[model samples]
Target: MHLREVRSNQFKLLLIALLIILCMALAYRLLIVRKNLKIAQQADELQEQKSHLLEQQMALDSLSRQLKVAQQDNQEELRQKQSEYNQKAQEVELLKQQYIQQRQYLLRESTIYKKIQKSVSTPNPDHKELLTDKDWKAIYKCIDTMYPSLSERLVLAGITPTEKKYCYLSFFQLDSKLEAFLLNVNIDTPYKNRTRIRQKLKITGSEEKLYEHLALWG
Candidate 1:
């Protein structure tokens, strides 16, 4: 009976030991599974963060490229405008030079014209002289060649019926108070030819002094 009791107790203790070891093994397996699950979750979160960072970097690079293109376009426009301004400035300078040269030439011609008129005219004349048809023709030709701008304004240029020594040069005025005015010029010079009379011809008016006249034969 004693040996039988001891065998029974030993069997009970072995069964308890086996039960404890099985419970311990189950707990350890649960802990390892939870750890592995947590590690997997962390890896998923890290991948998500890397994807977000990559999207932000791509956006930044696209914006940088757009900015560079915009800057290049603006710079190109600025260069084109600067080139146009330089070309306009050069054109204005050329026109200024031409104007200066034209002014000087007009001034020199005016001085020479006045001197020739004073030298050719006689102070007083004794006899009444009438201009011949040939003389009138030559005078008209000389005036047309010398004063084209004045000729453009001229309506009529002929010997005055009332005054034979003087000619009535009717002109149409533009942008002036008077619409038209007649200018009187002496044409009684000894010089008969167009070349000689061209140097002596003088035109004078109450509104404007046009040219010098020839008055030797009046």
Candidate 2:
């Protein structure tokens, strides 16, 4: 009986030892599982951060592209404006050239311009007029009062007048200047030149001209 009781006690001890070992192994497995789960959660969080970074990079690239495109568009607009300005400047230059050419042509084609170019001394002096001494006195008085400065500058040419219904007179210095001021005279586009041409006068020289006036003999 004693031997049998000893064996029973030994068996109980062995069972307790087995149960402790089993509990230790189960706790170790639980700790390993918890560690693995924590590692997985950390890895997931890292992946999410990497994805966010990638999205930001893409957005930045898109914005950069947009800015580059905008710069190109602005440069194109500036080029267009420059082209338009250049074209307009060229047109204005062309128009100015045309106007100058036209004005020069018209001046060359004028009859007075031809006469000024070809005139010589004593341009057709034997012209006739109808005037009395009273008319001459009246003209002298007008010249003195209306053009006092001119009277001081120019000498009046002497003219012989009679009741013979025709007379001729010559002018002294700056003769043609008086033609524009003559109002009470009838000229048939034929009158004696008061001064000679080609005496450093006419357009090619000092811009002087020879004009004639014809009065009806009454």
Q: lDDT for every model?
A: 0.41, 0.41
Over 4 Å off in model 1, which ranges? 73-218
What local lDDT score does residue 162 receive in model 1, on the 0 to 100 scale? 33
List ranges where model 2 is wrong by over 4 Å: 70-218
lDDT against true structure, model 1? 0.41
lDDT of 2 by residue, 1-218 (tens): 99999999999999999999999999999988886576456445534544454465565555555555555678776565555555555655565455434433433443333333343232434332223366556444422322233332222322222211122222211233333123123442123332232221221433433211211000
Model 1 root-mean-square deviation: 50.3
List the pairs of residues colliding in candidate 1.
188-217, 201-212, 201-213, 202-212, 202-213, 203-211
Query: Candidate 2: TM-score?
Result: 0.31
TM-score of each: 0.32, 0.31
How many collisions per candidate?
Answer: 6, 2
